[model samples]
Target: MKKNMGNADRIIRVIIAAIIAALYYTNVITGTLGIVLLVLAGVFVLTSLISFCPLYAPFGIKTCPMKKG
Candidate 1:
C-alpha cells in the first residue's frame, strides 16, 4: 500500500508506543488496561514501521506529503 504516514507521524507513533511500553514495564499500568494498551502500542509500532494506517485509508487521510512533479 502507498505510504499514508509521514516521517513525523511515524516518529510520533513510535514515541507513543515507547511511552506505553515504558509505563507497562515500570508497572505504572497493569492488568487488563495495561494489556490493552500494550497491544495498541504494538499496533502503533507495526503501522509506523510500515508507514501505513488502515483506519486512515477509509477516512481518505494522508499524512505523507505530496510528491512534487
Candidate 2:
C-alpha cells in the first residue's frame, strides 16, 4: 500500500503509543479501558511502522508529500 503518513505523523503516533504503553505499565491506566487503549496504541505503532493508515484511505486523507511527476 502507498504510504499515507508523513514523517511527522509517524513520529506523533509513536510518541502517543509510547505514552499509552507507559501509562498501562505504570498502573496509571488499568482494567478493560486500559486494555482497549493499549490495543489502540499497538495499532498506532503498527500503522506508523508501515507509514500507512487504513482509515485514512476511505476518507482520502494523506499526510505524505506528493511526488513530482
Candidate 3:
C-alpha cells in the first residue's frame, strides 16, 4: 500500500506507542486493559515504521504532503 501518513503523523504514533510501553512496564497500567493497549502500541510502532496506516485508505485520507509541480 502507498504511504498515506506524513512524518508528523508517524512521529505521533511512535510517541503514543512509547508512552503505552512505558506505562505498561512501569505497572501504571495492568491486566486486560494494559494488554490491549500494548497490542495497539505494537501496531502503532509497526505502522509508523512503515509510514502507512490502513485505516486511512478506505477513508481516502492522505496526511502526507503532495509534491510540488
Candidate 4:
C-alpha cells in the first residue's frame, strides 16, 4: 500500500502507543478499557511501522508529502 502517513504522523502514533502501553503496565488503566486501549496501541504501532492507515485509504486522507515525480 502507498504510504498514507508522514514522518510526523508515524512518530506521533508511536509516542501515543508507548504512552498507552506504559499506562496499562502500571495499572493506571486496567480491565476492559485497558485491554481496548492496548489493542488500539498495537494497531497504532503496526500502522506506523508500515506508514499506512487503512481508515485513511477509504477517506482519501494522506499525510505524506506528495511525490514530485
lDDT of 3 by residue, 1-69 (tens): 899999999999999999999999999999999999999999999999998899999999989999899
User: Scored by CA lDDT, what does every candidate get?
Assistant: 0.98, 0.99, 0.96, 0.99
Model 2, 1-69: lDDT tens digits are 999999999999999999999999999999999999999999999999999999999999999999999
Error of 1 at 1 (Å): 0.8
Question: Each candidate's TM vs. the true structure?
Answer: 0.98, 0.97, 0.96, 0.98
Better of 2 and 3 by TM-score: 2
TM-score of 2: 0.97
lDDT of 1 by residue, 1-69 (tens): 999999999999999999999999999999999999999999999999999999999999999999999
Worst 10 residues of 4 by lDDT: 1-10
Residue 50 accuracy (lDDT) in model 4: 96
lDDT of 2: 0.99
Q: What is the lDDT of residue 27 in candidate 2?
A: 100
lDDT of 1: 0.98
Go through the candidates in order and give the C-alpha RMSD of each one to the true structure. Answer: 0.5, 0.5, 0.7, 0.5
